[model samples]
Target: MEMFLYYIHLFARNVKRTPLFFALVILTLSIGIGTLLANLSMLSLMSTDPIPGKSEQIFNVNMNTYAGANNRFGSMHVLRYSDAKAILDSKVANNATMHYSSMVYSRRADSQDLTRYASPTRATTASFFEVMGAQFAHGEPWKNEHSNNIVIGHELNVKLFGGANSVGEKLELQGKIYTIVGVLKPWEMRPLFYHASEGKAFDKTDDIFVPIEVAIDNNWAVFARTMSTDSYTTLDQTRQINAYYIQVFVELLDDKQHLAFQTFIDGYANQLKEKGNHRHEVDNRLYNVNEWLDKNEVVNKDLLAFTIATGLFLLVCIFNANSLMLSRYQASQFEANLRRAVGASKKQVFFQGVVESIILGIICALLSFVLAFSLLALYRQLFDELAPVAELPLHMLVIGLGVALTSSLLSTVYPLIQGTRTSLASILK
Candidate 1:
């Protein structure tokens, strides 16, 4: 420990003598480390399991009932309303929830301020809260499925009620009065598995949630894609039509339940085939949360390619630092040889170099954080849709430090060897 501190003191004096060289090394390495760290942080967020423990159990339902082309992959992730309702009514799974996205103009019902904000809404069933593991801060999910009662997200609550518990308060949506039965706590689900398709995976959670039936009754317009041969003017008309819009997710506890649900889905498809409602072959599938995300391609391929490029850039930076350190060490050969002539072993010289590299690593790591933050900010500006995931979480911070230290040590290896191997007789003369 004493020797390490002594080496550190020597390193400080060396830096004082040639601060510009060290500064250049640190800047070069920080740029590479910071860029890599920024990319990694976003990638980590993009690929992380939105639901950790139950990700394997919660499944997204898909039925290849598309009339256009039955064998087309990824064409049937969304389901028709009837299909979603049938699956929910079957009671085959441990829990099930179905929803369709919508948009509405909302305001406090009794507020004298007539201004209304455009709100993203989820027209879902009562089980959505439980199935999605949403945390409630004030009240609970409404008991009545078709009632005017609704739920508000924390952000919406803050906007409407100043973050107070506003349960049982009245809210106006598109001029229709609805009671708030629940207010959610601050929660974010990355790669939002429920609606991962249609390029909406990284979007924020809906500001409001209402029962699907009530939404239909009130004619809340569907905010997502709806495909049908028949023309549908309202959400109610979507119920009986062949329009494919709603997304369904169900929780099955075990493989047995999963198989059972699959069997049931097959039987249901067969029934449709018998009734001539479905002309396509039965190709029903159940994708767990991660599988669903993969099917939807939630992780951007372009970002992945960019990450690889950043890794290569980091390598270039490492080599550049190595060259800089080589030059610095070559210039210090006189100092190294003088120590060797005065009884300092080659091993001791190498150890001193190692300690100096470690100090440089520590400084590089601290500076890298600032550079990484700046790069992340730039990424957020360029990729507005990915702004939510462009953050340095705790694990990514640790990884940055580890990478910086490893790079520093690696860059110093050949330099240290060459410095320690130099002849001492000339310096002693």
Candidate 2:
């Protein structure tokens, strides 16, 4: 430990001798590392499983139940209200829920402010909380599916009630009053699997979740894609019409449950076929969380391509840094020879260089963070659509540090070897 400290002290003295060279090395390394880290941070966030252990157990339901051959999306993964309700009522899976995206102007019912904020809402069933593993900070999911009770997400809770326990509080939406049955804890799910369509996969969780029956009865406007052969006048007509807009998710505990649920969906598809509802053959499919994200292509392809490009750029940076390190070591060769003449071994000289590289790595890591933040801000401006999901998580932060340290050490290897290998007498002359 004492020798290690002494080596670090020697490293500091070395840096003091050529501060410009040291700064240049760190700046060069930080630029490359920071650019790569920014891309990696967004990619990692996008690819992360929203629900870890239960991801495999939960699946997104997709069935080819649409009547038209020229489907806009070419995939009949979305469900009609009737079909969605039927599946939800089946109770075949351990837990199942169906939902559609809706938006409403909302405010606290008791507040003096008449202003209403446009809130992203979900018209879902009570099982949604259980299926999605959403935890409540106060109260619980509404027991009455037809009642006016609703659940508010943490962000909404913060906005309206100042982040306090908001249960039993009344919320007004479009001139209607609804009781808040639950207040969600801080829940953030990236690549929101339930409604991954229409470029909403990376969107935050809904501000409000209301019972599907209540949402329909109250005529909440659908904020999502609704396809129907017959035009619907109101949300209430959605149940009776063949309008396809809802999305369904179910939790099947094991392969047996998954198979059974698949079989059930197939039977239902056949029923639709027999009834002249569906024109095509039964093509019901269930995708696990990760599979669903892949199907949606939630992680942008351009981001992946950019990540690869940045990786190559980092290699180029390493080469440039190695060349700079070689030049710095060559200049210090006389000093290394003098130390060897005073009884310092080659191994000792090499160890000191390694310690110096590690110190440089630490400095590089700090500078890389500042550079990464600047690059990420630029990225948010360039890619506004992805701005919300661009921030770094703890794991990505640690990864950035590891990449910096590894890069610095890698660039020093050849330079450190050459610096220690030359004959002492020849270098001194």
Candidate 2: list runs displaced more than 4 Å: 69-73
Q: Could you tell me which 10 consecutive residues in candidate 2 have the lowest summed lDDT?
A: 68-77
- Cα displacement (angstroms), candidate 2, residue 380, comes to 1.1
Q: What would you estimate as the lDDT of candidate 2?
A: 0.88
**Per-residue lDDT of candidate 1, residues 108-129 (tens digit):** 9989999999999999998999
Question: Where does the lowest 10-residue lDDT sum fall in candidate 1?
Answer: 66-75
Q: Spell out the clash pairs found in candidate 1.
A: none
* TM-score list, all predictions: 0.94, 0.96
* Cα lDDT tens digits for candidate 2, 1-429: 988999989988988988899989998898889889889988998898889999999988888877777655444667888988988889898999999899999999999999999999999999999999899999999999999999999999999999999899999998999999999999988878788878888888999999999898888888888788778788898887778888999999999999999999899889889988877778888999999999889899999999999999999989999999999889888998898899889898888888988888888888888887888888888887678677767887789889988999998989989988888879775
Model 1 has a clash total of: 0
